[model samples]
Target: MTEKVIALDIGNVCIGIHPERCFGALGFRSLADIPREVLFLAGERFERGEISEAEFLDGFRRLTGSALSDAELRRAFCAIIGEPVPGMAELVSGLAGRGYRPVFFSDTSVTHMEELRRKFPAASAVPDGIYSYRVHAKKPELPMFEAFEARFGVPAFYFDDRAELIEGARKHGWNAHRFVSAEEVDKILG
Candidate 1:
């Protein structure tokens, strides 16, 4: 039998992420305090590896007019990453034991990815990954889906917290689901 391929999103699906924590760590009281250019444009560019890490930090400082040092900026940015989702590591192992090849499909920056790998076992459990930084495209984009199809031949199933990303996977002819909880994934996989 052909091995079943399953794509799992890393951010909110495998590891909990709280962007508010990052903003708070950076001394922002509310989301409104962050500029759209810094939050969206610079972030997306960083995730896509269009800019170097140093450049991203420089842009952030220039845009926000903050006095944070490079190390402080990195720490604040990585603060968004939390612990791995409960039971997600075991679920990943279970998927492997059940003959499902689990792979990470995510849009994440280098700093966030490094933090996740260092802190979350589940985030590193899956050996295979197709990241936006490497792919040069983010989710909800055609290029990401195309890259997945080109590499893995269209995943048998894809799970993500975002409905828009799920729709993107579906458009690529994959069975995609909005990930809610590990229990929901267990039921679906079983």
Candidate 2:
């Protein structure tokens, strides 16, 4: 059997928003500043490749009417990210080293995504075939998983933090995990 694993990290803002993950000078804030409609539109634009990072922020500001600096909002969103989820990245990377593949499936929007690319070294770890908001479609929706299967074939395991998403994956006859920690992954893999 092919022992590849397509590990997914989800986020409205990012996979993990823990403070230490913050790189530049920052302050903690929440998505309260931006509207769901605005974020959704940003995702569409990101997927369409029609706007730049600066354009996304300007439009988002106009949509939200919030005066918070982008830098502050970035810090707040980043702060919400829980710390590494205890060896989550390592576990995925270890699996990859052993011939398993790890894919980051997300529903993150365009503006936040630009921040994500700068926050994490995902480009080097996961393949470019990642499904993000820019790609349209979100988790808990079967089409994204279908696309994943189409691109990476079936993974030995598909892990996601969202139990709802996991349930959807299992429906497709895929072994899915409600990723809590590396320990859970170890338990399932072992």
Candidate 3:
């Protein structure tokens, strides 16, 4: 029998965070203030485990020359992530009850995931989490999906908040769904 998986993206799907809240909290007005490539490289390195958290913070410090302390920096970094989406716990429980293995697949760093789990302990109940920090790759990139498939043997359903990621999973021949609301997901998966 084929394994049925309900792959969920953490950000905006299970939990909500402003896209640029962290950057804004760090006093970056726009990408123009910090070169997009520089930001991407730093984030990529951090998320891919190419550097330690201290090194990642130092990269930001070098870029912005900010005098923020480590605690302050961590606070600002986690400022974006907030509460779990409405009905997320119920939705996940319902899916699992129906034999769909609920898994978390996120383009997230250790710091953020740590903060999120602390803030919402229910998130830790996910059977498995494939984080970018550990996987060294993010969604919309096939390596992440390939790794997931290699482990779970290709999910029956993949749900994410982004169109690009949904499209990417579709290309891999998975039944990918663009997660909009918990109610909608429940209706479909029920």
TM-score (all chains, Cα) for each model: 0.94, 0.69, 0.89
RMSD in Å for model 1 = 1.4
Candidate 3 lDDT tens digits, 107-184: 888898888787664664686878788888877777888778777777777788899888888988988899989898
Which sequence of candidate numbers ranks them by TM-score, best first?
A: 1, 3, 2
> Who is ahead in lDDT, 2 or 3?
3
| Count of backbone collisions within predicted model 1 | 0
Instruction: Give per-residue CA lDDT, model 1, range 49-89, as digits (tens).
Output: 89888999999999989999999999999999998888787
Q: List the residue pairs that clash in candidate 1.
A: none
lDDT of every model, 2 decimals? 0.86, 0.60, 0.79
lDDT of 2: 0.60
Q: List candidate 1 segments past 4 Å from native.
A: none
Query: TM-score for model 1?
Result: 0.94
List all candidate RMSDs to the true structure: 1.4, 4.8, 2.1
Task: List residue ranges in candidate 3 displaced over 4 A.
Answer: 1-3, 30-32
Worst lDDT 10-window in candidate 2: 19-28
Best by lDDT: 1
Better of 1 and 3 by TM-score: 1
